[model samples]
Target chain A: MVETDMNSQAKADRKAGETVLVADDIKRHYEIPQGAFGKPRILKAVDGASFTLQRGQTLAVVGESGCGKSTLARVVTMIEPASGGSLRIGKTDVVNASRSQLAALRSKVQIVFQNPYGSLNPRQKIGAALEEPLLVNTNLSKKQREAKARAMMAEVGLRPEHYDRYPHMFSGGQRQRIAIARALMLDPSILVLDEPTSALDVSIQAQVLNLLRDIQKRYNLAYLFISHDLSVVRYIADEVMVMYLGHPVEQGSRDAIFASPQHPYTKALLSATPVADPEGKRERIVLTGELPSPIAPPPGCTFHPRCPMAADICKRLVPPVQRVCGTTSWCHRPWEAETESAA
Target chain B: MSLLEFTNLSVEFETLNGGFRAVDNVSLTVDPGEVVAIVGESGSGKSVSMLAVMGLLPWTAKVTADRLTFQGRDMLSMRPKEKRKIIGKDISMIFQEPTTSLNPCFTVGYQIIETLKKHTDLSRAERKNRAIELLRLVGIPAPERRVTAFPHQLSGGMNQRVMIAMAIACDPKLLIADEPTTALDVTIQAQILELLIKIKEENDMGLVLITHDMGVVAETADRVIVQYAGQQVEQQDVKGLFRDPHHPYTAALLAALPERATGDQLPSIPGVVPGQFDRPAGCLFSPRCSFVFDRCHKEQPTQAGKELGCALCHTPLVAGKPQNEAA
Candidate 1:
């Protein structure tokens, strides 16, 4: 019976190249009111970001803190509506969708937070936590929900006996496993993983990464992987989008971005990340100064104050999007231009 | 003489279930102008051993050591007042969380001045100037204005800079930074690490860096010590330890890095670290070790010679293979 279920699920898998999510000029802004006498100020958290995700592929969004990566995740999962632009998920126009339509769309996209210890309810048992989604979303009976939750637990490497245990009884790694299991219970097509392994040990991180990859392959799921660790992004991301202060500075294939980073910020980010190899000798380009305040970002380019090769034009005007060697960059003087001139 | 010498240090905490050894037989030495790193996962007791050195552990912790000295001065037998004089003056520490480590109620300048008042004879005017100078040395822009700002007013990186300024306010001879940059971003981490190394060199201070990041270890450390389950498993120079780790746990941990992976599947070590109750009688890592033998499950292993990284294993690995298996 289990073998037939596996065969049927394999047959039911979606086409590998189908586009599951598309975002165009997505923006999430917050307006802070400064007392009733003063004017309201608009803070652009995520501004003019666009990307597409296909089945069985991972598109990682990499940035430092307060860069709006988490805000982007919230917008994509329909937890909050975007302030502007369009988002289309599997032919459903999410921006203009009705309430009933949104209720159905929410289940199609699921998110796993960074900290497992906080995300789970302490008083709730593992079985109830897994079944809560099915109960609220579907009309499945108690017996059916229990069967499905147990299957998911087994799939995520939890034992049958662990079904009755509380979350505090589990270790960090096991808690993360349970979190992943809970996210997968809805059979979502898109998964937004926000620093899923940042709080875990290296050994446990490897295990979770392997499990994510396996689940992605098995279900042909689209993954919007978000992380600040560039090494983990380099390993898991098929395409990488580098964001700085609410702007997409660079976007390209993983190999292209890692090998020949055109944007100054991207180069600095790659260099700042310390490689584990002691023998590998590479020039380090440490960017000076912290991220500028997003509320009142730099006049022109958000990264001009920290760019190593910033020209006078960079400080006066925003750089237009330019494509070079299969990578898109927002920079006035990309390294490729200098290299090409030298050549 | 070494700047700091710690021999056979152990810390056992009294819990409801009796005694739990958090640090077992850990020995470390630091000469001036050297950086030694203690690398381990959480609960590996890397921070506890350093806390024990500073006499900062709680009263419930039972600390025992054969010899704990600093620059030929005995630290273990010193009175509380004498130890206090040396701890914050000659030996300072920077904690992992910069925001929480600082007092939120006071201005950053006041915090730095407080440190100076305790350890230096400078007058009020001179101490204020010194505080601004220290902040400038740590690369904080407009130090004059930043000194007046409270801890909650500055960013995380800025607060960390303030913390560094306070830690180095007295010109300490030895600095113990416990995961100082773990709470920071990569770009900020780079800035903080560069600032730390610069300060260490300028002061000629011995530095002890406790972290779980192998990348940071490779970039900064002169010597590396790998700890597991409160025990020191291997000790070697930074290059040698990364290139050819002699302990199975160390090898597996290096393999687990995402940057070191060659394929999709990382060669992860199986199972979790042993707790107090579930700790094995023999090798603490035997349950998760790949090359475990029958003897490993029965008897504890002793430390090997220096060539083998002083690995705590009966069959220490050499170039990824067991050395005693061939014999």
Candidate 2:
């Protein structure tokens, strides 16, 4: 079974820079019932997010809470179907995928959640937990499953003695490693990491991030990294998608996004993130007013209410996508000065 | 006189596995209008020390200090009645997890007013008016309607603002904010931090910021205390600490930050923090320290001189090199 799996993986690796996942204006909406008499109000958790994730690269979705980064993760991983738009995982269309196609897609795409404590079952031993995925998905024998699980444990830096230990016995970082090992049980091509290190300490987070980078290189896996942490995003992400109130306000390469943010929202977000260097010159654009309720989000470009450079037109009309310095920003007045671009 | 001071403070909690020393020997002093940040990972006892000062710890915990004073008044030996008078009135605290810290049974206004009623001699009308003003001061829009709103009605940021307002109701001389922005979004965190600083400046209050984020410590703290497994690993001014960390643990922690990474892989510290049972016999950080030696594993080191950022290491780092190592 392992040999067959390797052959299939080698066959799939024929093309370099293969696009593993392509999300075209994927959206997820939740309708809240307003009593028996009133109409149901629509909550646009994820409005229109479009991006393509390549093999052996990371595309990070960054936003504050309620900005639908998690919702987008669910959509991409096919855990929750998008209310609109399309998602293609290598050639399989997610919108109309049959049972067998979905089963195949599930093995190809796996997710590691934020809270390792809640994600794992306390009663389940590490070995059994890792093998359960194989038990359900593949026809491998029990011994073969145990061998694969043990190999994965070693790959993730877990000790051989820790195989029979319960989840409760392991620390947070160790549990997260277990979670990552479980996600890789089927040798997924695309991994969805939704705030994977947010719950961890800085030191532990570093270890996990290094592990992720190592695993990504070894497996040549494409990663859909979802997080609100810009610093972490700046480190791991090849491309960045900045979301605001379920809208992709800015989308560009990591350098372009970090060095020269075109959108005002992106600029505010960058400035708001406190730099580790105290001597670093930072022009803080402290945005006033909290995020507007997504249920009754302001008309036009939902960010107009809090935008420092907001004009009359900005409040009345949604801004069209403007491309500048290899970055796309949905704003009426994007910083287009060529001098601001990074060398 | 210093706004707050702690000399050789220690906190031990009575757990199932005997006495667990949550906070080791920690010495700190905070002047009025100073921001002192206690930075460490979870189980590092950054919060416990501050909680010891606030007298908020459970009865099972034993708190000891050679000198624990607030404005020259010894807090360690103060009577319960006297301590209560000074706690909410002079030295207030904003707890972590605003959602859980706030009482769901009462309105935000009622809560703020309750604090005022306990600390001040204000009338009912004046208390209500003060509550609204406090809400408005914290950047909560439509303060009039928000005062009547319950904790559930407000967002996490707004609830945090309310918590701040409650803490500063009586204009505390020393404010202890324990992981205030941990539960908040970055934008909201920025706002809350700005608000705290603004409040601290206006009131000339000594602020004790207990958090783990290096970015936050760099941006906000005047002085920083780096804790590792209940021990004061290092203490220095924010700028110097970031520029030249004198402790290996401090250096490793700062290097572990993603923003500070020079390459693809971050220089991470190996192994988790020593828990109650698995604690090392000598140095608490020795097992994980990159420059660990046989001496470090055998004998616990005392705090180094001020030149070394008061690092609790025998071979304190000087310009990233161990000072006591033989060539």
Candidate 3:
């Protein structure tokens, strides 16, 4: 009985040690003036977005260009300050961290940007770019850093000789690999990969995705992946968050979202994504009208202006985040599981 | 006879390193009201080949072609002003980025009105009337209000519709859409592509769509030209190309696509496109070709390479050409 108790305690402690990225009611806002010397308008970017990124899992934040997905990522990654809500990175208060404190916070997370060329220096060699993080953060010797850089390159499926070559010499996919290697330099437990393979070709996209999956398995790292590409998000993400205007309208497990999405915005987004097959028939939820300006976002429900099922109440009151078919959505009319099954 | 024809055309861009041939000796034809998709990966020379036909090639670009005729006019022999007359008025072109393509300083309505003024001899009132009509035709509601909005103010999809509104402002004979929907989301892309096709059918205008998307080609194109390393690898009907692509490069493109079909393994081509300086002596595709034979390596082949494999036009084929013989 004592032996069994001891084993259970060890398992519990180990489970406790495993970090889960929790964003509790995260909010960020920017002040924009209405007129010259007039009252400042509080432009809420992300208003109370809450989710958790468990260890060895990916949580995709998907939305249109100005939907505050990038802002959420930026605020969560400590690149920008959050206005309200607390960020617990394995019990560490990331939202309140100072520059040096954030620098120490760097040991936990890293980011791989969207533009492969923009993220990587044009003049710098791949090896040097990969070695930069190690040199900055650690007391590792020059030789040790070089060795780590080369190994990281191989981990990302780039050749060792590519170390000498610059970013310009490599293809879009190859350049992305270099960027991934650079991000891995800190041995970061969490990676906020922002549209990592968006610029790459289809075949190269597959290769890079496979590499990411392999690395995730090896390192057991958490990912806060941001992408507008649905197919890629479906492939890599364990849980998905759909953002609209400045709020997370829908979020659930990958299977739950794909097999049966509850939110109308999520449904519309899925419909918007062009399936590759020429013969494949997708019932398109054609969303008409432009995404309203962030400065003057629509009252109550942001998507009401273009939503197919918007009612009078939908435009008047903000819908509660109610559970529908096990998926949570800030929508008045989430598709019920029984209705989905019937359909 | 076809509206546009290319015979043994090759384009070379002179760089500091050397004269790099961006488009090899190629031949293609576009009939009146026909939609021809030129599909290939980046650096495949599909866009460059079309650019050559438009006489848009610069002074540094050495264009060697036996014949590049447009409606019986020798494009290669045309003067500067004569080409300019045909470029926007008779042959309008739409670029990928509608945001960047539309000038930010001016309103979309004014820009489109300017296009009408440049191409046609209409009064100020007549031009405004036509501009509003064009905007409406492209499915923009309340176009009068939208006309005043600058490119930055409009959404990406809306801006693209405005660009189409401008491109078709003068009712050109042939529309060159170079990846017009590449930057757009799927639903918006569908709308734009459908609108373009509808306009083409309505006006009976020839279309030259240059894109890397096979899905777009399969859905819209009647026929297609598969390009690789500045050369025509395969030319077939859309059905034929998608059903049974001939050239290895063409096959790779189709295979590279991830379909909605339930399949665990997605087809992927192993190697990357070779650099300009490092192009192989023989077939540009030979290094990556799965079924490369002896002749594919030894002889530097061009347009004629496509002729040999062509099922429609069997041999006696050209010296280097292989056509779509694959079943």
Candidate 2, TM-score of its B chain: 0.98
lDDT of 2 by residue, B1-327 (tens): 998988989999898879989998888899999999999999999999988988889999999999999899988888999999999989999999999999999999999999999989999999999999999999999999999999999999999999999999999999999999998888899999999999999989999999999999999999999999989999999999989999999999999999989987899999999998899978889899889888888899988899899999978998888897862
Taken over the whole model, the C-alpha lDDT of each candidate is: 0.93, 0.92, 0.79
RMSD of 1: 1.5
Go through the candidates in order and give each one's DockQ.
Answer: 0.83, 0.88, 0.33
How far is A301's C-alpha from truth in model 1 (Å)?
1.4
lDDT-based ranking: 1, 2, 3
Runs of candidate 2 with Cα error greater than 4 angstroms are: A1-15, A337-343
Query: Residues A207-310, candidate 2, lDDT per residue (tens digit)?
Result: 99999999988888999999989999999999999999999999999999998899999999999998899878778999898889999999888999899888
* Model 3 residue B135 distance off true place after TM-score fit, in angstroms: 3.0
- Pick by TM-score: 2 or 3, better one: 2
Task: Put the candidates in DockQ order, highest first.
Answer: 2, 1, 3
Best by TM-score: 1
The worst-scoring run of ten residues by lDDT in candidate 2 chain A lies at: A334-343
DockQ top scorer: 2
Give candidates' CA RMSD values in order. 1.5, 2.1, 5.5
lDDT of 3 by residue, B1-327 (tens): 677887889999999998999998778888889999987778888888887777777888988999888887888788978888888887888877898888889988899998888778999999998988988999888988887888998888898898898889888888989999888766577678879989999988999999877777877788888777777777878776666655666666666664532344445666677777778867777777766667667776434334233421221123224443351
